[model samples]
Target chain A: MKNIYVAFCCEYKKVSHSKMLWITIVLFTFIPMMMGLMIYVVRHPEISAKMGLIAAKASLFGNADWPAFFGILHQSVATIGLIGYGFVAAWIFGREHSERTMKDLIALPISRSYIVTAKFLVAIVWCLFLSVILIAVGLMMGKWVGISGWSHEVFVHGMTKYFVTSFMTLLLITPVAFFAGYGRGIIVPIGFVIITLILSQFIAIAGFGAFFPWAIPGLNTVPEGTEGMQLFPISYVILVLTCLAGYLGTLAWWRFADHHS
Target chain B: MEEIITTEKLSKQYKDVLAVSDLSLHVRKGEIYGFLGLNGAGKTTTIRMLLGMINATSGSAHINGMKVHAGNTNLWKDIGYLVEVPYAYSELTVRENLEIVRRLRFLDDKHVVDAIIDRLNLTQYAHRKAKNLSLGNAQRLGLAKAMIHNPQILILDEPSNGLDPAGIYEIRELLTSLSKDQGVTVFISSHILGEVSRFATRIGIIHEGKLIKEINSEHLEQLCKKRLRVKTKNNILAREVLLQNNLICEEIHDNMFELESESAIANPDEIATLLVNKGVPPTMLNVVEEDLESYFLRTIGIKGGAK
Candidate 1:
């Protein structure tokens, strides 16, 4: 436990000093603000006409209401959150190899398992912090756009669904972490994230999102009763299993694999 | 002396290439074991296996009586190492990087970082980011990290690389002091035989993944081949005169005759007199002992210039 704490502090300090942390924060903040602008455009069709392309894009939001705003926020979390959270995991695990510092961590007094755990802990905190930013900024934008149907129950329900979607997306980041270590750099993991993102879209459209871990999070964003989009109990099991496999795989790689680099 | 580090028939096979094969060596307490090898000679691979960064294919490494394995984290408590080209988080300052090491090592004393910074002459660049540091300074930072905890053992690979002459001398002095004063055992690997000969108590030469030779530094000088080099103004008569005197001689280079005979080297005056009487007076008569680099190359069966 003490080892974990010490390693966690070191991992936290590294993340805090990195530009990636702030970059992700700014990016997460920027996404919702752009969504708010679209909501504002949907609210005022006359002004949206003057905006041309921006207006045409805003038409997809349908109505300028709380449900529409929250729906867009959930879908964005499932999609954008997948890539963003995966990037966070990739940077945290892959930077050690990319920067050639992995050798320093291997033979430390602290266990390599503890260091790997600390990295995941930092990644979780960072990704969750980004999720909060996405939600908080999205709410502010909805208010600024003067969307209707604001109530405590609605707010509670929307925020709950948004967070659950974000949590599911965050779980899938572990595989990215594994790829980061196996590949010995960020490029492979980022490539893995992009590939998964594209496949998630296709797999979901093909009606197998319930079985695909990458597609499950995005499917959760759909209305609970939407045709062919309903998630099965096995989907959650598969998600957890994927997360577990990645976590264990990363630990094993650090412990058993020959780290020549 | 008690052995502090040991490897028994340790080998690592990477697919088709065998990086290290049946290697066995030991470092006694307070002894500076210089691992000498050229590039791609399994120096770094052996170090990695010793540090438990990689597993051996056929044998094992043990430190302080404990087997080396990734799960054996306790073994690393007394060991500090710097492998090929030390790299820290580039974005972090020198002080911050040391601080990270300090926290990870669970050292309560915050002053160790400052002390090491001063000790390594890195006080001026304490606040500089690692990315901004010059190669020598970065190498200094790497040494600082290795020595910060003052571990009982240190395993460094090519540590003198990227350092100026002065910097290298300073590090050598520091490491010698650490071994002498603190009773620390150092296993350092380098391609520069001459440099390692200056400080290492014992040297092991590895060639093509095998431990070819091990020699004590004290005996290294005597083990080096010595010969008498004679230069004369005479065209071809000097070689014949020396050869006729029952002195084995050969013209190694232009106007330079080399005599490897004990009698010739022991008493060059006799050869001088014989040459002068033969009217091929010697211009340069000197006994030249082979340098460590030459000896190293010769031992490795490579009859070429030093690496």
Candidate 2:
């Protein structure tokens, strides 16, 4: 237990000191800021018309109210959060291989399993921090834009849904970690993320979003009364099972596989 | 003396290549065991298997009488190893890299990091990021990481690589002191026979994934062949005179005779007198011993760098 704690602290320090962490923070902040800009343009159509193509595109978010603005934040977390969290996972797990530092960790007094687990913990914490910061920035930008129809009930509901969607997206990062280990670098895992994102969109469009683990998170962003967005309990089960498999597979690969790198 | 490192029939077969084949050896406490092999001769493979970085296809390795397995983290507590080229977190400073290693190794004393830095002469580069360090300093950081916890057994692969002559000498002195004063058992692998022969108490030469020769450093001198080389104005006459005098001699090169006879090498003065009397006065006559490089290549069944 103590060794795992030490490994966790070391892993945290590694991630915290990396420039990638700051890059992710900057990237996540931009997504919400872009949503806020769109909300602002929708609130004033006369100005949007006088502006160029970007203003015309921003008017697509109809009726720039508090609910519509929250919808933007929710959907962004479901989709953008998926890619962002996947990037974090890939960087955390794959940097050791890419940098050829994996050998330094293998022949240590601490078990490889502990090191792997600590990495996952750090990734989780990093992704969660990004999620929280994105939401906070999104809320502040919404207020700055003066979106109407704000209420205590609506705020609680929007925040609850946003947290759940982010949680679901974060759960999918384990498979990304596994790919990072299997590929022995960030390229393959990041490729896996892109493929999964593309496939999720196609599968969700085919009316089988709940069946695919990657599509389920996006489906959760659909409004309560939306048609064809209903998810079965088995969808949640599959996501949980996928997460478990990835978690265990990564640990086994670290502990049992021949670490030639 | 207690045996600190022992491998029995250790073998590793990778796809179509036999990296290490049925190798067995023992390293005793306070002994500097130099493992010598040419490039692609399974030196790195053996070190990796010993460190449990790779699973052996057959056989096992034991460190401090404990079997080495993937999950046997306890065995690593007493063993400090550097396999092949050492790489660290390039973005982290030299001190930060050592701190990470210190935590992973479970060292309680925080000051050990500073001590190791001072010992390795890395105090100047303590705050310098590893990526900015020169090759020699990077090599020093690797050695500091391995020696931070101060384990009883040290298994290093090419530890002196990428160091200047002065740095190599300093490392050699450090390793010698560790083994002598602290009783640390060292198993170092290198392709440089002269460097290893200078300090290793026992030397093992590996060829084609097999242990070809094992010699004590004390006996290495006697094993290397010595001969008398003679150059004369009339090489043909000199050869003839030596043959007539019952001395075995061969014309190695133009006007030069190589005499491997024990008597010829021991008493070159006698041959010179005989040559002068025969009117083939020796211009040059000297006894030379075969260098370690040639002896290594010869033992591995390669004739002077050619198969």
Q: What is the lDDT of every predicted structure here?
A: 0.93, 0.91
User: Where is model 1 more than 4 Å wrong at Cα?
Assistant: B245-247
Report the C-alpha lDDT of model 1 over B1-307, residue by residue, as the tens digit: 8999999999999899998999999899999999999899999999999999888999989999999999998898889899999898899999999999998888899999999999999999999999999999999999888988989999999999899999999989988998999999999999999999999999999999999999999999999999999898884888877667777777787768898999889999988898888898899999999999999999998876543
Off by over 4 Å in 2: A225-227, B240-257, B277-279
The 10 consecutive residues of candidate 1 chain A with the worst lDDT sum are A60-69
Displacement of residue A74 (Cα, Å) in model 2 is: 1.9
Task: Report how far off residue B75 is in candidate 1 (Å).
Answer: 0.6
Top TM-score hit: 1
Fnat values, candidates in order: 0.95, 0.79
Clashing pairs in model 2, backbone N/Cα/C closer than 3 A: none
Query: Each candidate's chain A: what TM-score?
Result: 0.99, 0.97
Per-residue CA lDDT of model 2 for A1-261, tens digit only, reads 897799999999888778998999999888889888888888877878888897878867877998888888888999989899999999999998998888899988899888988998899899999999999999999999999999999899999999998999999999999999899999999999999999999998898999999999899888876777767899999899989998998998887778767
**Candidate 1: CAPRI quality band:** high
Clashes of each: 0, 0
Tens digits of lDDT, candidate 2, B140-181: 999999999998999999999999999999999999999999
